[model samples]
Target: MKTSRYILITLLMIGCISSCSDDFIEVANKETLTDSSFWQTEDHALQALTATYGALHGADGSKWTFFEEIYVAMAYRADDQINNTAETYGRNLASFSNTTEDSGPNNIWKTSYAGISRANQILEKVPNIEALSQETKDVIVAEAKFLRAYYYFWLVTGFENVPLVTTFEVELQNLFPEQSESSVIWSQIEKDLTEAEANLLTEHAAEWKGRATKGAAKALLGKVYLFQEKWPQAEVKFSEVVAMDYALLDNYADNFNGNSENGPESIFEVQFSGDRSNGNDERQVFNFEISPYAFGGWELFFPSKWLVDEMKTDVDANGDPSERVYESIFFDDPKSDMYSMEATAKIPYSDVAENLNNPNYFKKYSFNTDEEFYNGTNITLIRFADVLLMYAEALNENGKTPEAIIEVNKVRERGNAVPLTTMTQTELRNQIRHHERPVELAMEFGIRWFDLYRWQRGSTATESIKSTLEAHNKPFSENFQDKHIIFPIPLQEININDKLQQNPGW
Candidate 1:
């Protein structure tokens, strides 16, 4: 959709004009827009919203946000993936040796706030635009609210007790406000999503595929409740989303390849384009970073041996490994076809020389070609399968074990895995936590890591983080502490505002 083109143009138009020639001091610059002159039209409102979406990928207009560092920060702490590169920040995060001064947390903090600031600007200015209709303004405001909640979700989950800035700030004093309690932040998220669900459209046109929808808001609200252990509320939200028009794609592989983007399975996706030749650098770098060296990729991160073993434990109706194993990772399996090979070549995993020694490389998002490059594959943030699984989890927690089994079976059937028989609530919970989620959603986003952070397996939070990582044979399990669950506030941020206090143990 050339979304990046809009972002680039809007950034230039809205950016401040800091300098002018002395000879042209009296003349007005028609090229640059001031805040007073910009918020006068519907088009300007849309442009500003586009800039907010742009901040999702590049808040500072420098690097792809989820490409490398952020991905490592979100996913590496869990056991599924391991860092293979020598980057100090990535290594520190993976090993639990990070400090408040580390760049990984700082980058995430800055990028999320950048998005929040843009969203706040829209919430403050768009409603007053004289040229916009009330309906249009409602939709735009709903989207801004959703984006703000999405950004804050990352902040509160990743960095607990962060400052809550709902309004756009111009004054220096307002910019450096004190951090709010996590409970307060959660209330704001729920409020935003509830309003968003009421106002957002059920679906968007094909041209506007990645914008937030009513179903997306409901699903995210369900997730928020799930994280908070509010089982009844989470179940209600998820049940509403289940009633919406969405389903699992028949071919599980369709979820990852660029072929069926924004299809029935997607609730929301981060839109990316492969056509950088047009000066629109919106391509995603997941494939480039995770593919094996044989495919001309950097091999920055790959599936851990433990995850490969876990995927092999499940078998389909035909008494073979589940189809998800072959589809999700490239391991040394004779039955699995190597996606990087030519279609007619019939290359299997065992035949690839690179597969002989490596544990496994991520195959879900890798381009099915030998050449290494960025791709336009839209990263699905919330999909139907995930919602179904989460619903199952919530249902189980709320004493609906049999009903929850129905939901979990729906996802398992799609993956060609055997369905579960009746089991106790505790047994089913373990199955969902240890096997179903890790196998189904590994290496996608920080799902695994976030799951670990929220779960309390032992007597305390510290025990949960340590035991889970230790069970997975993570190298840094021994280094985990209570403070390791949520990252310390960035030292640079604290230095800028004395009101900010670092998280304990930093």
Candidate 2:
């Protein structure tokens, strides 16, 4: 029902906003702007652009949740790693382990397409502007193009084939181009990112602190290269970003704090604000991670035991798990036995009473006791640390172990963990896949799955995650395949677009 209403409202808003009059006085003469008449003013163009940002915020949480569900948890489940409330999600997805079409994947397709539609509207209309500065207009167009590429990348990465739409004609409806090859979609993504990298200025860092930046485009381009095994290019692009002024935050915890949402380390983040005029901002809905039984918020997701134990391990027998625990995972009581309680009953009632006070749970992204944007911390979509890690990945894949360790060590030093002086390709690859990503990118959506795919180690890593969970007395889900990797084409799209092919084995 909520999804239905969202679509209705979006269509209505698009209609009202697209049409505008040419003359200033003529604007008053028209009954309100409708989809057919609105793109007449610079202000109108700006408002439309802002709406795209708003959609981005919504897509962050919604898309992130699905990415985590299908890519990360399902792989862990297939590996028998941890049980999930989203077990239904894993089970349903399992049926398509080798395939990709189903009802479950529909929402992501719809959401992404909606974003593309908005971007197409801007790309088509922005050029005609005699009103806005050319520079301003160029950046806006770049932003839209950047987003279009981002959305298509998501589809291509998962489904391998996706429709490529780059136009502004509602009459072109039913123009379901058959699933374009992944290579074709990637070529388009590369074009957008390259243009975006060259066009975006670093100066917009203030007004658009969390929005896309040149560094963001460069970093994304590098990631796309890494995905395609274009190692040298990926290495060069990531190196370029690393050379830029961005650096990792001194404290890993600060990156997640509400006040520091756009910290120096964040290359790009989804800008979620608390200043919603009509309804609650879903972006500010931080309660999803908090324990629902104790607090009013729902503890809908929790860190997998595989994730927790791996971080908790003494990688070098350094006597302690380094200082990263405080930032990566939350412990309700710093004094409690984090590895030992037999059950919830084993937990002292005193601890239960002080549950809200307990700090043992993951608290890196916690809200302060009082703040207007309590749940509104901007979620970092890409950060310098991620860039560093991806750089390390490209270097390692290219068989440059020493250079890769340098990248890994840079991130480890921040955690106070000992860094490897050297490692083999296998060791570096394993560490990058199992340790570095989970710790560095924990709680951020889809990092795990993407890492697995890049390494082609999804099957083994899934098992490894499962084993750790089982040993720790945690539940693990099972049976993952290709369809589980991308997601089913959204049921709605399949219903509407005949040219669309369901992912194989769906």
Candidate 3:
């Protein structure tokens, strides 16, 4: 029985979040720590785990900051949206001219480590409680381990060689731990996720819906394998997940429909509730239901010309454009009330594509309904379509092109689009490159840039990221030197921890 203390943990954790900018929330609340004498029971353990989940969604409801760091900072470094605005870290990251001192990566580093600290605290404290059954304790610990690995996954992916810490204790010398090698960090992620898979429940009861499960663990472990290019392992893990209860929702747009959240398609979602008084709202001022509401709604993201044109290439068997194009982007539709910040007016997009003039807005995170507006829309992290594509990529990499297209068609069929004909491995690889990932998941978090990185990196890597950027007309491709491959370890970390050395090329 989870305690009413869930609210208490949220209040404490919110104050503890490290803010990127000077201005941040510091709630007026009673001291929670001193009064927390009832933490020995099952309910207390549940509240602690809930706190970890809260940490996942920007510590203490500092919504805009986390998205700015991981989504905007890292996402811009790859070819996705055109560099539209100069505010936040958008232009610098979009141009690939950012530094270790940049606030985006630095704040994310602090937040990521803070999350790890909380998970470590839970792991350390939960086992000692005599009130929890062995079964309950194992499950609780597994959740903590999974959350820890998730934070590290972001850390490792964003900044390759991060200092790894498991225990909550920090000695004088431990504040600035040295950067662990990427291989070493990968091993730790694998170990944590593997244990998490073993101990977590196969399925959660209705009350425990979004909590980590055996399916979530397997899906993530499969992704880790995909990132490392461990094809056969990735394929096997993805296959196991596909056999489970997860499936694609009937409509592509349903994934973003707030009422349709936590459906079978969702492997993991960063849950949000618009409790404005509690400061738990998602902070989605950028994508509002009605444009011209709230200072023009900012309309932060402008879809790239490449994204729009590519989407136009594929239509349904009925010759109508893919529903995803309509669902994912909002252009000059007179029916829509989207505000174009560039135009400085409350107007729909220009009706003509040729004259559209960077007037596109991302609709995925836009309003679903009045009550389920901005702050309440849960962000989908991994979905069944994404996993299917991962499985397809792994299969293609391992000389299984024909079989790979089967999964590709599975996704295409749901969208009512034309399926691929028989093609050689080389041709199928090109198809996945041009049609698959970018179309299925555009402007949905950082998938675009992540795909760009995976395709253009390392010895086994094929295709030129430079060419893709060129094809998209990104102005910064000329200056994106070889060293821009991964983010530099934040300079602040090096200044503090002498053991931390700067990544060579940065």
Task: Work out the TM-score per prediction.
Answer: 0.93, 0.80, 0.87
Candidate 3 residues lying further than 4 Å off, grouped into runs, are: 1-39, 278-283, 289-295, 332-357, 371-375
Ranking by TM-score: 1, 3, 2
lDDT of 1 by residue, 1-506 (tens): 33463373333234455547766546456767778778889878988888787666656654455666666688888888878846443788888888888777787898889888888889989989989999999999999999899989999999979999998877667878899999999999999999998999998777777888999999999999988988899999999999999999888888898877888998888777765675657677776677666655667877887888899887898778888777888877778764542332435776676544366787887765233355678888889999999999999999999999999999989989999999999889989988899898888788888888778522212237788788888877798887888889998899999999889888
lDDT of 2 by residue, 248-343 (tens): 778776787565666678787766554445754334444344332454434445566556667776243455665565556654433322211223
Give me the displacement of residue 502 in model 3, in angstroms: 1.0
Write model 3 residue lDDT over 68-164, tens digit each, in one string.
6556765676555765564455677777778878877776677778778778878888888899999999999998999899889888877788899
Segments in model 2 whose C-alpha atoms lie over 4 Å from true places: 1-31, 35-37, 59-104, 172-174, 276-283, 314-318, 331-350, 353-361, 369-373, 457-477
The candidate 1 region of ten consecutive residues with least summed lDDT is 456-465
Worst 10 residues of 3 by lDDT: 1-10
Instruction: Give candidate 1's error at residue 296 in angstroms.
Output: 1.1
Name the candidate that leads on TM-score: 1
Q: In what order do the candidates fall by lDDT, top score first?
A: 1, 3, 2
Reference-based TM-score, model 3: 0.87
* Angstrom error at residue 384, model 3: 0.5
What number of clashing residue pairs does each candidate have, in the order they appear? Answer: 0, 30, 2
User: Over the full model, what C-alpha lDDT does candidate 3 score relative to the true structure?
Assistant: 0.73
